[model samples]
Target: MPFDFSQSHFVLFGLPTTFALDRAVLDTAYRKLQAEFHPDRFAAADDAQKRLSLQIATRVNEAYQTLKSPLARARYLLQLNGVDTQEDTNTAMPVDFLMQQMEWRETIADAKTQRNVDELEELNRQLAEEITELTVELAELLDEQHAWSDAATAVRKLRFLEKLNDEIGNAIEAVLF
Candidate 1:
């Protein structure tokens, strides 16, 4: 396929190395790369070429996945800037954020226990809004201000919000079924 295998994910997809990306552009590039390097297209080629095609296809898929998810993209951006998120080693969060998390969890537990679908839905809405806000802040931190440490902290918070959102989804399913 004449593609550089060692390129970063964003470079592979011809994307600018920024937190704020256009989804439509990413989607188009992903599809174009997949079509260009699809292994099936190399079915008639020599074994060596076929293997290369397979590797290329695998890399393409991996890059697409990393670029598509906001959490993954944020982490990748931080990594590109030589900033380790330290998500595991740095578990210490602000007390106010911790308190807010506890409150949300308590609300979730109560609503789930009571099978209150409406409350669960409302909480889900609020969580979505918070996620959106954090994402915007991350875009500014990573793209505009180049605040790597602040971006890393924001990424950690985003991960927590995503996990909590998943829990809310599970609770909604439990209450429904």
Candidate 2:
């Protein structure tokens, strides 16, 4: 009841406003808030109290989900400041980046066609390493450097890596089946 429904997630939880969050603190805040505002805790109260509890609970869930993922957190921060991160509108990736992606896709396709598990595993390993590097780059841009523009670029790279990850998984499944 003391917490304001009008507050943002960081404000509601009395947390600092930042792109990179401490997971432990976030989890603790989420658990504490959920326990405080859970509808079950308001079941014995009047109808209005129960309804308010439900709304607060829903807000908490939305905040938790948005703050938990790097991609979602970045997007939320941009939206919070009235910025449209129209990643798709740019549609102009460097040609070298596109070529690299195509090469990886081709390598994956060839590996699957030959039922070469070793090649698939090696590709997966390389992709995983690359993704890890991209993650670090994103963290540095978003957290340490506070370079939102560069962070946006990093997000694009991360998205591409995510797509490649899915494609690699599909290739693995095909080889297995």
Candidate 3:
């Protein structure tokens, strides 16, 4: 089959290495491909064939997940381009972005001290909006403009936003609790 589950997501889906992808197309293709090579459909086949089918099915699920998430997709694109974001490397962001992050942290800290859930929620909303804007910026940098070097820097910022976003969610949960 042309769509080899063992192949990378880009190869399997015939997509370019980019964050922006047609979700509908990916989902539809996955469903159709699943239907075709489902192990159950090959129940009458030999043991090796059935095992191979199972392996291929697992690969398809893994690839789908990696492609679905923006962060994962970005990391994958980086790897494909011979860039390795070291697993242990601490993300170093620019001073302006660091200053913005510090402001966010201060706001969160101040809100917590004041015991203001509304303020916390508002901060979360703002961060969420910023994350959305960064996501679009990432797509433009990686796909439209072909700016990998710049995109690499943006990805580092994105990692920070992701961490902050998770912290905000946890903060909300703590408030609710």
Each candidate's number of clashing pairs is 0, 0, 0
Ranking by lDDT: 1, 2, 3
Which parts of model 2 are misplaced by more than 4 Å? none
Which of the numbered candidates is closest to the native, going by highest lDDT?
1
Among the numbered candidates, top TM-score falls to 1
* 76-140: candidate 1 lDDT, tens digit per residue: 99998899999989977889988989999999999999999999999999999999999999999
What is candidate 3's CA lDDT for residue 76?
82
Candidate 2: the clashing residue pairs are: none
The TM-score between candidate 2 and the true structure equals: 0.82
> RMSD per prediction, one decimal?
0.9, 2.4, 2.4
lDDT of 2 by residue, 1-177 (tens): 765767777776667777767899999999998999999999999999899899999999999998887777777765665666667876556788889999999999999999988898898999989887876776777667877777777677677877898988889989998
| Runs off by more than 4 Å, candidate 3 | 1-6, 40-45
Q: For residue 92, give model 3's deviation from the true position in Å.
A: 1.8
lDDT of 3: 0.80
